[model samples]
Target: MELAEKLFHKSRREKLSSMLDENSLVIVLGSTNVARSYDDGYKFKQNKNFYYLTGFNEPNAVLVLAPGGMEVHDEKSKKIKKTKEILFVQKKDPLRETWVGRRLGYSNVKKELGIDTGMVNSKIGDVVADLISRDKYNKIYISLFDLNFLTGEVKEQLRGFESSWITLSTNVQIMDVNFLLAKMRSVKNEFEIEQVRYASTVTAAGFYNTIQMIKPDMFEYQVQALLEYHYKELGCQDVAFETIVAGGNNTCILHYNTNRNKLKSGDLLLIDSGAEFNYYNGDLTRTVPVNGKFTKEQREVYQIVLDAQYDVIKKIKPGVKLTDLKKYSVERLKKGMQKLGLLKKGFDVTKYTLHGVGHHIGLDTHDAVANKSIGKNDYDKLVAGNIITVEPGIYFPEDAKEIPERYRKIGVRIEDDVLVTKYGGEVLSDSLPKEIEDIEFLMME
Candidate 1:
């Protein structure tokens, strides 16, 4: 890790520590390996909140942060003054390491992660129990979820200790650390924005490459495989989520990932995917004609969705509310649909235009922040450094009698990752072509 990123994570932990009252303890538990089959396990993904604070990726680890003025006893049982931070990792096991991978052990964690103290997992319950018995902590903050990965004999002991501590101490309060961390992560820092931009660049490249390769009669899984291959070749450890390569009416089913159908010549293909760089994710979606040219009806609906996306992106600036933007984008789509004669008087456009226009994107796609709500005074305001998506779509299933014959079974959506700025919004995925002419030109090869 770069020195700057190390400092950035350290500052985040310090910020959280500063937010707590005196004699407060924050417990962050890492995720454990889950069995994919009998003995083999799925890839380990660290808990996002734990990764946000500690920058430690290993499983079955715990990070404890105690604010200043907390009395703690070290391994030697000697009293220590001031703040304390301890990271507990699994002890070295040659057989386990040989089977899977080498363990970092406690010594390396302290040096590499810049943690104040590091100990084996077995010691955590005893140490925490000692602190509780001594009445050293007034407030305890733990992960909000009932984490399935957080299990073992050590954890059982700690759980027992916590239950007893709560029963004994009326003054001690337990709080959810996830809430505090969510508010901190809602806004991106400079390093985080840089990472997102890099991820966005890679994501756009994958889309452009796939666009050039897409052809009539190609299987949907083939397109998914090609795009994912490009993402990995460009240096992304993995995709942020499952790649969605929906062609024809399959595009109407949002979140469709069973990419097994063949592409039809006149159908529109929607590719909604993103790449992850250092855990930062870039979410992008684009729809294009399968045979490199749109028909009259397809072009009409595409243009309307494009206009709505373009207008929504223009309104993305600090202080703008998401609800207001959604309403504005819907009105734009409604007018466009009415002009096309798809809707009668008083017909609601939202019937065909399902889903929200966009959402915040960051460490996780559909970032943890709440969207700006309905009321003018009751919404979250867009702020600089906020990363979001601007996606607008019009879906018409084949069975809809109200829909026009030519436009049936057609779905078109255009999405881009945007970074909110003081002056305006910056398009992070602009490298990928969204214009009709540009897309056709690139696909001509």
Candidate 2:
């Protein structure tokens, strides 16, 4: 990380510490390495909350924030009083380091990362037990996900410990800390905004590279591989989520990942993918002709989706709720579909539009604070620094009887990343051409 980036993380930790009560303790657990096979494990991803607070990516670590007046025992058994933030990390093991890589082992964390103290992971349970045993803390904020992270033996010990603690202490309480982190993460700071911008740029470049190389008879996975290869070569560690590259009718299947079909001349290809940079993510989706030219039916459906998406994005600003935007999108689509004679009597949108119109994008592609409900007015108000995706899609299955035969097996989705600003929404992905002529022209090049 750059010096400025390191300072940004340090300031974030300080801000979190300031939010705590004087007698409160916060424990955030890092993610563990999940086994994929015997002696092999999947790539470890640190908990987003832990990373946001500490910027430390090591697995099996815990960040403990102790506010002022916490009691501690010194080497001589003397009672010491101080406020401290401690990082409990894996103990130094020469054999393990040899197998993997050198661990930042229990030293200089304070000097390097601005943490107050560092300790071995083995002593975390004992140290935490001793601190709470004194009844100094009135409230304990713990990651709810941490319970799932414990090993079997450690979890058994924790169950027993909780039972004993419940019997002994009436004032101490455990509370979910994720809500606070979610609220904090909902708004992007300057540093986070820059990272997301870079991610979006890379994502767009990858899409352009793939679209230029796309042609009839190319397998769907080949396109995905090409885009991902471009992303990795540009220094991205990993994708934000599983890459979705669907061709023709496969695009009707939301969240599809089986990129096995060979592209055909008249079919459309839908790709939904994103890149992660410095832990922030960019989500983008684009549907284009397999032969680089949209047919008549494909163009009609694509135009409706594009118009609906544009209307929704134009309305974004501080205090605009996503639910309102969704409703507006439905109305826009309904009117467009009706004008095009796709609607019969009622406005049943599920026939064409399948999923939600948009979602907040940040640390997670579908960010933690993105409103998830379909209730009429249930949603979060957009705020400046909030980054989201405006995606509107229409899918027509081959077997459907309501639509014309010419429109069958067509899927079109136009997605773009937007950032909420005081003036309105700034389209972060505006550089990527969504206009039909622009796309065809670029493909020609």
Candidate 3:
């Protein structure tokens, strides 16, 4: 299903209501971008948090939820409560639609979004003012830090009636809605998981296709072009992030996106890329030898990274903290590097294994989660339905004299997307070959 079709408003409202005390009014603001000149014009993407809550992708919108309103009786003798959700949208405009695009006015928004009521944007000031004027609602919950159109207008209204008897007595509180929204988006729903799976599948195809088309003499940019072509052909809206096509010694740079290098006979090419589908993303990385085969030294380093990655994958399940995973992977890398003699008897292993093994992936590549620190007993357990990456890498530059001569100038990273589950972690991007023999075979094809 399309993102816009999801019924996220109810869950979002529940979360907001849970956070707020009784008698509070919460307002979310969204607006269209208006450039000063034609040359500076740009398209606007709907705020991810706002879109996550309401599934409203259009610009110039507001969502209001009043928790403490007077209860009235209806004709059926049932208690008909006051409005819980009120949406304000842009008024219909023919001229604007001609230049830009058609907008679903108030009527359509109410029916489609399942809100209690919908109104014109022009009347928002009056409606909000009246709602605040009521003496019963003492606490007002407005997203203070957001400087969008609705927030600015609400601020002006609050300033306008600051001296009035009703407004002066009312206690208004500002809440950081961004934090509340981030917590909501950390866990993935069934629909969201499905969309992410589709994106991962397409991304895997792109990686496989790009690898098959790669030649020893091809420019890195040409390989990047092939990956992009496959992404588009597989119906990806766009790349999740800039494509990284680092080759040879350049792979030592973690985020090398400059695809200007030439693939030599003995160099390894590393690609870290993914595709975006329905605003969800999939992240994967694979490193392969440019000449369809890895040198003995390259295979040694590659096998170690692969082993670390596999060990982490086997331990991924519910209640697995990211910190423990990091420690475990580091220990494995340290042992592997020790066997290879890269580290002396007691040298700190972190010097070689620098970055974290993985991170959350979703609407944004680095999606939010509860874990803030990597402590020994950190309780940020891996919950079911959360998508994460398991990437293990070893980078050794040419200047590092401690390593063997053949192992120098070699960087190998293998990453894959995984979905946490109750039984065990499911490897979403398993279609891509990670084994040394399999990669060599595919490259030969």
Best by lDDT: 1
Best by TM-score: 1
Which residue runs of candidate 3 sit more than 4 Å off their true CA positions? 1-4, 31-43, 69-81, 122-130, 135-170, 345-347, 373-379
Question: Per-residue CA lDDT of candidate 1, range 1-445, in tens?
Answer: 5677668778888999999986788888888777899978888887777778778888888888887644555553345634478888888999999988888888776568877777788877887777777776789898758343466644664775666865855878877887777677778999889989999999999999889989999999999899889989999988889889999999899999999999999999999999988888988998999999989898899999998898899999998987788888889999999998899887778888898888888888888754544554333688888888999889998887788788998998899999999999999999998988898898896
Candidate number that wins on TM-score, 1 or 3: 1
lDDT of each: 0.84, 0.81, 0.77
Please provide, for model 2 over 306-399, each residue's C-alpha lDDT reduced to its tens digit, 9 standing for 90 to 100: 9998889989999888878888888888887888898888648776888778888888888886354445533478889989899988888888
Model 2 per-residue lDDT at 32: 77
Clashes of 2: 0
TM-score of the candidate numbered 1?
0.94
For each candidate, what TM-score against the reference? 0.94, 0.93, 0.85
Residue pairs with clashing backbones, model 3: none
- Regarding lDDT, does 2 or 3 come out ahead? 2
Better of 1 and 2 by TM-score: 1
Residue pairs with clashing backbones, model 2: none
Candidate 1 deviation (Cα RMSD): 2.3
